[model samples]
Target: MSKIGNDHLTETRDHLINEIDSLSESQLNWKSNLESWSIAQVCHHLVLVEESTIKAIAWGVKAGEPTQSERKKVEQHILDRTKKIIAPKIVEPDTKLFEMQQIKDLLNDSRIKLHSLLSTVEDKSMLAKKSVKHPALGELRLDQWIEQIYLHEQRHIEQIKEIRSLYEELTEAFSSDHIQ
Candidate 1:
């Protein structure tokens, strides 16, 4: 695995932990509206995505035919929150409310699985040659799939921040109303 890819994965995971470290159970589960995902839901969705991504990468590396295609610059595209991409059913979070510790444990378990898989791959260059088809991004190499995990998490980090802001506003309004 590329050092850059590993670094990005570690960075995003740490950032995610920091983002939700102080959130209360209620805060983690509070949604702006029925249609919006709560922070807990977002974290759950990320866990699902990471697990699925690891499977895809493993499959591609083991079964895929090698190719000479270059990696696409998909970081910018993945990070663009303006474009709303619906989560696939397989990766969607359910209605379960997750405690902060639960979320962190799930995140850590997925990260461990991912790192273990990466460590076992003896030929790192093989990752660049193996390919899998992405729904929106076309064919991506096994290595690119690894990168996608972090890039996708970064997108949802922004969403988590937005949810936090909305929660703060709602609480402040509620407090103001009680004072009056």
Candidate 2:
């Protein structure tokens, strides 16, 4: 496993935790509009994606044949908020409201599973030789898939920030009305 990939994953997860650590249940579950997701939902989605990605990576490493495919530079593309990507049904967050601690625990558990799986790989270099099919990104090397997990999380961290901003704005507006 590459130290860079591990560092990116750790950094992104830490940032995500800091972003939502102080949020109340209402703040975590509050959506700016009916069509948007709350902070909790965003974290739930990240958990789902990471879990699925772990399975994919495991399968690719064990059963997949080695390929010399060129790696796609998709980090910047994943971080771009200009393009809105719809979540697939499998990865969609349910309507159940999640507590902040529950969301944090879920994220940490998923991270542990991913790291554990990576550590068990017999050959670290196989990560770059094996390929997996990403829904939109086409064939990605196993290592790239690992990187994609954090890149995807970083993207949603931005979304969570936006949700928090909107939540604060609405709360301030409501408070102002009550004060009047």
Candidate 3:
């Protein structure tokens, strides 16, 4: 892995684990801003990326994007999905209201699958070839795609921190047991 990819994966994973560990049930549901995603929603979103990427890697290995026809087919699906929801963040909450385990289970499974692919991905060429069709950035190589995922996680990790801090502040202000 490149320094950037390694750092992002490590840091983002740590932050995500730490943030989730710190959350109370109440805090998980607390909305930081009117337009913001709750912690559960954020978890849901991140898992979707994990799940998608795992599938992508599998496809990349099997089909090995050697043709433009294949790339465009996959690209269209990505484009449609992206157009529907620019980023995973803005997607609506699960109709089940985050009580669903689909996201979590998918995340867990995807993590395993993704790491398996990464471990065996001897083809460094995939990182440089335009394989992923990101809606916002158009087309990107595997390396670039990985970086974007890192950046996306980094962005949300910060959001998680901010939401937790804000939630703490608001609670402290209104908390009845003013120990001070």
Task: For each candidate in the order shown, give its overall lDDT on alpha carbons.
Answer: 0.90, 0.89, 0.61
Q: Better model by TM-score, 2 or 3?
A: 2
Runs in model 2 lying further than 4 Å from the true structure: none
Candidate number that wins on lDDT, 1 or 2: 1
Task: Give one digit per residue, the lDDT tens place, for model 2 in 14-113.
Answer: 9999999899999999887788888899999999999989999989988746987788987877888898888888899977899887998999999999
Q: Per-residue lDDT for 1-180 in model 3, tens only?
A: 476676767677666767676566677777866677787777777777766665654565566554332323333443242343456443335523454344446556656666677788786565555365655555555665566555666566666777888888889887856765
lDDT of 2: 0.89
As for lDDT, the candidate ahead, 1 or 3, is 1
Among the numbered candidates, top lDDT falls to: 1
TM-score of each: 0.96, 0.96, 0.69
| Model 1 whole-model lDDT (C-alpha atoms) | 0.90
Scored against the true structure, residue 164 in model 2 reaches a CA lDDT of 90
The weakest ten consecutive residues by lDDT in model 1 span 61-70
Model 2 CA RMSD to the hidden true structure, in angstroms: 1.0
Cα RMSD for candidates in order: 1.0, 1.0, 6.5
